[model samples]
Target: MLARRLLIFSRQFVNFTPVIRRQFADSASQTKTVKFISGNKEFIGKGKVGDTLLDVVVNNDLDLDGFGACEGTLACCTCHVILNEKHFEREDRTNPAGEEELDLLDLAPEVSDRSRLGCQIKIMEDDPEVIEVRVPSVTKDQRSA
Candidate 1:
């Protein structure tokens, strides 16, 4: 009797394994495309398509103001933007912020848990269909006394 009960539990656990795996895989696949929305503007960046978000931002000449300040380099915090939660979760392809990037983020106003440097994020060959980010209005220096 104990052996039969153990077999039943094992079978149930095994049956649920694929369901759990599929959920994880689906979440990952859904994160490839990046869709950025700020204010009333909405922009979609095609992922796994050999084009970086910076490239799209510049090519399209996005209305965002901070780009002119950074020159697309990681030097300044002007390119600071907030990553949507879904994008934040799939940011694994991009390198994590270094000490310098983190320091710069500290100088960005409205910095939050999803803060990321626009220049640091790169498009990956197998990324999701969309990722969303939000640009803030002010930098820390801009709010100074």
Candidate 2:
């Protein structure tokens, strides 16, 4: 009976080993790093998978405008920026621009296909390469204010 019990325990241990190893492997695979470049500036931020672009910018003091106005609420498009082509492709899906954001973007001077509110973009750090985005001038309202 003791031998039978030991046999059952051995089987359970064997079965659990792969599960433990897989969990560790998955966590290792999910680790991510973030890098930002705007014109002459560049920075690398150590981030997990779900960090927002604004989070990195805020933490790094990336000289983005509108950040002081809206406080990252997405209320004002002062943090308007253009995502570089390489960084644009790294985003998982294009987050749909809300009516409020669209209206705010209208207040931005140089709106384009690549225009995005920095506060609205959440970074997906799954890619192997660093992402780059550019901060544009402040919105008309912010500039005048």
Of candidate 2, the 10-residue stretch with the lowest lDDT total is: 87-96
Highest TM-score among the candidates is held by which one?
1
Number of backbone clashes in candidate 1: 12
Candidate 2 lDDT over residue span 1-145, tens digit each: 6774575456436544654565466775243455555446665665444445667667766555335376655457767767766555453254456576678889886777777776666554345556656665423565565
Per-model C-alpha RMSD: 14.8, 14.6
The local lDDT score (0 to 100) that residue 21 gets in candidate 2 is 64
What residue runs in model 1 are displaced by over 4 Å at the alpha carbon? 1-34, 44-50, 92-94, 138-145
Question: Cα RMSD (Å) between model 1 and the true structure?
Answer: 14.8
Looking at model 1, which ten-residue stretch has the lowest summed lDDT? 44-53
Model 1, CA-based lDDT: 0.62
Report the C-alpha lDDT of model 1 over 1-145, residue by residue, as the tens digit: 6774575446435544654566566664222455667666776654433344665577666666456375544568777778867666666334566676788899888889888877666555445455567877733475568
Regions of model 2 farther than 4 Å from truth: 1-25, 28-39, 43-46, 63-68, 86-94, 138-145
| Reference-based lDDT, each prediction | 0.62, 0.59
